[model samples]
Each structure stands twice: as C-alpha cells, then as structure tokens.
Target: MGNITGFMEHQKVPLHYRDPMERIKDWNEIATLPTEEILREQASRCMDCAVPFCQDGTQLAGMTTGCPVYNLIPEWNDLVYKGRWKEAYHRLSRTNPFPEFTGRACPAPCEGGCVATLATDSVTIKNIERAIIDKAFEEGWVQPNIPKHRTGKKVAVIGSGPAGLACASVLNQHGHQVTVYERADRIGGLLTYGIPKTKIEQYVVDRRIRLMEEEGIAFVTNTEVGKQLQMDQLHSENDAVILCIGSTRPRDLNIPGRNQKGIHFAMDYLHQNTKSLLDSNFADEEFINAEGKDVIVIGGGDTATDCVTTAVRQNCKSLVQFDIYPIRPTKRAEDNPWPQYPVIHKVDTGQEEAKHVFGNDPRAFATTAQGFTSDKYGNITGVKSVNIKTKFNEKGEKIRDIVPGTEKIWSAQLVLLAIGFSGPETGLIKQTKVALNNQSNIKVKKDTFQTDEEGIFAAGDARTGASLIVWAIQEGKEAAMECHHYLMRNVS
Candidate 1:
C-alpha cells in the first residue's frame, strides 16, 4: 500500500452527477470526471487488508462478492497513489480488457467487499479505474498489441457483445486470426444499442472497436451466421467457432391487451432510440415517442431503470415502475454478512434523476399489472394493476395473491416491458444442433466450454443466462483458452 494511513486521512470522494435539468436535456454522460489529484487521493484510500476480498471474486449467498474479473485492486491503487498512471492502467488492463466499459456500466460489487466498508466508507474503486483507463487513452499510452507471428489458425466469434469481444480479443492476442460476426449493423451487441447513450457515450465503444480492428481482428457487421451464412460453411472456414451470442429473447408480458399498439419491449424502445440518435442526432422521425404520455415500466432492474430515465429525457407526462417483489431493506440483513454481496436497497443514477424530475420516487413495490385498457383505435390508454402479497403454500412454494378490492386503473399511453431475458434465442442453436440446458441456455461441459457438437463452444450469457459484463468477459477469456488449446492439439 502506498499510504498505510490513507484511509484514516481521507473520506470516500463520490462522483458527482451533472444537474438533472441540464443533463436530461441531452444524451451525454451525466457524470463529470474528477481531477487527477482528487482521483489519486481516492485511490490512496484502499486499505492494505490482510485478505483482499475486493479481488477475491467469490460467490457468497448466490451473489458475487467482489470483482468477477479479479482486478488487481491493491496494486493499481498503489500505482495511482504514486502518480504512476501508466502503470496503473497496465495493471488494470491485465485483468479487464475494457475497463472503460465496466467502469461506466458495472454495478461494482468490488466496493461491497472492500475492507474499509466494514467500519468506514469504501474506496472509490470504479471511479479510480475509469480515471486510469481514460488517462491511458489521453496520454497515448494505449496502443495495438499486434502479434509478431501468426499461428495460421482461424476462429469465428459469434456475436460482438462483451463476451464475444473479450473472446476475440484474447484469441487475437494469441496470434490466432479471429473474426467477429454481429447480426446488427453495429459492432457492440448491447453496448452499441441496448444501452442509452447517456450511460456510456458511443464514442467510448467506438474507440475500443477501432483498436481491436487495428490489432488484426476482423468484424463483419449486419451478418447473421445461421441465416446469412450457414453453420456448416462457418465450420468449414474457421478452425473453431465460439458462440458468445447473448441471451436477448426478452421476457414478454402474457396478458390480455398485450398485442395493443404503443406497447413495446424495453430493448426495442431503447434500441430504436439509440439508433435514431446516432443516425440523425434525434432529429428526423421520432423513435417511440414518450412525450406527454403516461409511461408504465414493468420490472425493477437496471433495464427498467433505464426505461424510466429515457422516458424522462423524452419529456414523458408521467412515469411509474412496478415491481412484483417487495422493496429490499435499506441496510444489509444479518444473514448477509461481511464479504457477502449485500442484498440491500440502492438508488441508481437513473432512479435518482427520476426523483429529481418527477416530485417523487417512481417505483411501486409489490405491485403487478393485471391488464390493459385500450382506446377506440386499440392503442393502450390505461393499465389495470393490483397490489399483491406473497404467501407460501403447503409445498413451500411461493405464490403471489392479489389483494381483494385493491384493483385500480392508471393512465398509461405507453407500456414498456423491462422484465429480464429467459435465455439466448434458439434459432442459431437449432440451426447448429447444439444441446441446450434445461433453462434453454447452451449446454457445455461441467468444467469446459465445449458444446456437444464438435468444433463449437459456448460462453458468456449464451451459456450462463444474463449476467454482468465482468462475468461475461471472464467466460469469454476462459473459453478462448480452451478453444486455443483445442486448436493447438488438433492441428492437421
């Protein structure tokens, strides 16, 4: 540790968001960067713990305890404290290939496991990480790591999302020719379109994609493998095929009036907005206009929060989010002890902005949407909702029972379903004839990434269901290693 008593001397310095009124007017990132000196002070606060659980990457109580990528937290913190910005970036890049992405979007379970959090405020690890990577780019420290020699091996990475990108990056670094295929017009799968530009600027994603191209990785956009290119053709061309196709089939709300107009899936709404924003800077044709409409978002996750914030930016008349589950406790319960990821309430940036724009918080816990009411043209006009309580049956199965006489109608011109995804779409899996798990995810070996089909492997969200970017990166890296080894051994 650079400063042993640094934790005692400095309190945690939190990142400040731009004023809601000013930031909501545009799609730029709401966060303002801290100065180098202030960032150094924040990094210095990393205590020299005997056991650094911040990077332990353990699963406790079915939640991630620390960084899934196992970032060298203490080492980089010390480097930043000594003003070794380049060294700090290198240390961070050693584990996470894209710190800028994680630094911006990751929920950062690392801070929850920080030793300092036990008695005092935890280190601003995510902010410091962002500072390191952003500095590396500013100072021209980041460059292409082109391999001197080629291994004469070709690998095909399906989907250019976080997992696919990570796998392609690693395989390319190992001197193998890697080609990434994306079904969308852009390179990044979710990072490019699903996420709003307000969270991570498109240029940040573009910068990394440009670097990867410079490093000799080929990217084919608007190319769907199973449809445009046959699976057998891909198998014949590439030595190995790694499927990082993310779980993107959104969970639908199956109720009466689901087919009504003006009701859309969250991703469809978000994707259209980002695409239009980039195409013409939000001018031209409107994309899912929420202006002056009472919007109802169904779910209580990050995607749902994104919907809330996006609607606010569009100047929606009113916003309300419904969660079937109860609100979490403000503080960690006794069962969630130290080193365990706390299951407590948190107000994300979007939620905070929503509160600022609307006079109150927009979340309604233990609430379920019963059905929808429509106008003469069949466009949704209102939502029928009821508050519900959970009860355990004789077999110990939890069930939700609607409270009698609690049904109410709320005005809603637009309904966005933000419920989580079930698993990866089965089109490619069916075309390729790969086995799937009970949950519809690609089934790989217990400790390997190899699918039942030869020369095909699955990783990331496609195999593990929807998860954090860090976990997806880890899966991609591990799958790359296994794929590389298989390629080396099976050389004809």
Candidate 2:
C-alpha cells in the first residue's frame, strides 16, 4: 500500500504528450516524459481495494477486462510510489518480458479494472510501469545474463514477433539453445514493421533485440522458415518448434474496384512507409505519399486511427474513416458494470491528433465502403459508401443491413483498409500440414500449448485469433513452461 492518505490527497497525473501540430511534423513518440515527482504522485493514487481486479484478466460478455498478462499492478505501483524503481522494474519484467512495448501500445485493461476508477480516477499504472523500465535502461541495469548451464536441446522459433520473442527469451533463460527465424529483413516483426514509428520508435525494438542476442538467442533475419528454409530442416534441427508467426493475412474488401491501385491494406501501407522512412526521410520517398490527396480509411480500431493520423501527418487534403458498426456511447451502459471492459467510446491518441488538426473526429459511424473509382491508369479516384444498420438475428449473431438511398460517393485518391486479420497465412500451415480449428487458427489443447505434432507448440495470434499483445506474451510464457516439461520428459 502507498500513503494511507495519498489517494485522497493526490489525483491521478499521467504522462504528457506532444501537441498534435508539433507531433504531426515528424515521426516521434507522442508521450512526453513527465517528471518523476508527478509519476510518484500518480502511483500513490492506488487505493486499498480489498480485491484488486486489475490483474485478474477475464473474458466477460465476450469482452476481456483487466490486464491480460496478469501483471502485478498493485505491487509495482507500491514500488514506484516508494521510489523503488529497480524493484518495480523487476516485478514488471517478471510477468511481462517486454513492458516497454506494452507500456507504449497496449490498451491498458488494468486501468479499466482499477477500483479507484469506479469512484475516482484510476492510478496511472501504465505510465508508472513505462517510467520504471525506461529508468532501468538509463541506469544500464538491463543486461542479458545467459543461463549458466545449457540444456543442449535446441529449439527453433518460427517468428520474431512479440509472441516468438517472448517465448525465445524465456526458453533461452531456461538454458535452451534457441534460434529465432524471421522472414522479414530485420527482427521485431510487427514491433518493427507493422507498428509505425509514430507509435513506437524502432530503436526501442533494437535495444531489446541487442539484449536478446547478448543472452545467446540466435536471430536469423530475412529467413523465411517454410519458404527459404524447409520444415524438414527445422523438424530435425530443433528438439521443439514454437510457431508464433502471427495472424498476418488481412481481412480483404471483396467489393468492386478493390484491385485498383492506391487501395491497399493498412499493414502494407504502414510497412512500406516505415521502410521508406528508415531508408531515407519521408520527403525523399515518393511512394505512398498522402500529400494533397483525399484519404479514406476503412475500419474502427487502433489501426484505422493510425491510418487517419498518418494521413494527417502526410498532409492529405482531406481525410475520412468509415466504421461498419454504429458509434459507441461515451459512458458505460447500465448492463456493463464494474470489472467488465468499458466498451464506451474514448478518443485514442491518433484520433485526438486528427481532431486537433482536422477540427473534427474523422470517423464516420455506421458506414461501409461499397466500391472504389479509378482513373485510366488504375489509380484510385473516389470511394462509394453506404450507411448500414446492425441488429441481432434469432441465432443471436449480429448482422449488418445497408440502408436504402444512403449510398454516397467521396473523393478518395488514397484508400487504406484496416479491417483487421482473419488468421495466419496458410503457407506455413499448409506446408507443415498442421490441423486448424474451425476459425482457421492453429488447433492446440487448452492450457497445454501442444499441437497435434508432438514436441511442436503454438501460441499468440496463430493459436488464438487476432488478439491483444498482452495475451500473446502470456501465451508465449505458458507455452515455454509446457515445452520445458515436454522436453524434460524426453531426458528423464
């Protein structure tokens, strides 16, 4: 517990972010480093709730509430309040291998479940955790201490994303020889490529990768396991295989003119933009520029907000985002009480940036794209959209109905589809002949991460559908434990 009277005396003061206009001018992190004194006050706001539901990650009414990684929020908050940053960092890293990433991109369900939020503003757990880890890095305390004893059993991890990275890091700490294979030119799959530099700087990822390498985790970049390398080689080389390739195949727009140029998936646009920025500055790159063009983004998630904000930074003449579903309320509904995910609408950092620059929220609720218009050379010119209404059927499944006479056209020279993903690509699964669940996700027994193939396991988006980063980290840790047990059985 913090100061007995701290919760009453101090209010929750979170991190400060750069002004929208200033941030849109370049690719830098939005959150400004708040003073340590303010962060300490924020940490002291943690109330003496008898049952701290913040760490009890649970799914209720088809929605997740609280921290998915089950982080020790109370413990860490107390540590930060007491100025024990090293202890706070250790407790945070004990559960979440990479607090730096989650501290940046995560939605922070822990905040939602904070009992203080029910009456007063919640403690700033996310910001406090971020500060602790950053302080650890500054003090040069974050070093890779390789296991003293080697198990001599080799393991091949078939991805370098969060899940794979977490699994590899944990397994390596457990004394296994781990080789991480990444298809991309560099490590940190989504963290490096999919996530824009505006959200998370690439060097943050680079630092973690350097530590992993120093810890004896072998990272082979630009090496596609199923394509460039064979599954047969992986099977023979490693004692266990952990597949964490992620759900990469984007959900597509089957409507007319989808094949037209300038209409691309969100990840492709983000990836190309990041690569171009890394190679040179945005001014030098002509490809994927939204300058002076009408931009349209389709989807209503973090990714769509990113598209909108990115286009704003690109100085698009105008921008509009469409969500197929209706808008959410500003406050929780009567039925959705405490300990449930607050599904009410709140502006994300990107939306806030767009609002500051564009004078309004760019998202259009209850709208869906019908088709696209193209120029003679197949460059996108405009987009056709229609309003839609949603209702539940007899089977209790929600369905969308396009409203009649609501069709409209908007000039959109650039269209980005951020409709989310279906599942992982079929190339690796097809080649390996792994069994898939009905949802096209890799099938594995619950709790135990073992796939049908003995000594082979699956975790993260490949096991579950598109999910939160915290869940992926948890899955990776659990799978490593199960894999450890399976590997030990062979030795004994």
**Clashes per candidate, residues 3 or more apart or on different chains:** 0, 0
C-alpha RMSD of each candidate structure in angstroms: 1.6, 1.5
Model 1 / residue 4 / CA error / Å: 2.0
Alpha-carbon runs more than 4 Å astray in model 1: 391-398
Which tens-of-lDDT digit does each residue in 100-195 have in candidate 2? Answer: 998888888888888987887777877887888899999987988789999989999989888999999989998999999999888998888887
Scored by lDDT, the top model is: 1
What tens-digit string does per-residue lDDT give for candidate 1 at 121-155? 88999898888899999999999999888999999
Each prediction's whole-model lDDT (CA)? 0.91, 0.87
Which window of 10 residues has the lowest lDDT sum in candidate 2? 278-287
Model 1 scores what on Cα lDDT? 0.91
- How do all models score by TM-score? 0.97, 0.97
For candidate 2, list the clashing residue pairs, or say none: none
Model 2: CA > 4 A from native = 283-287
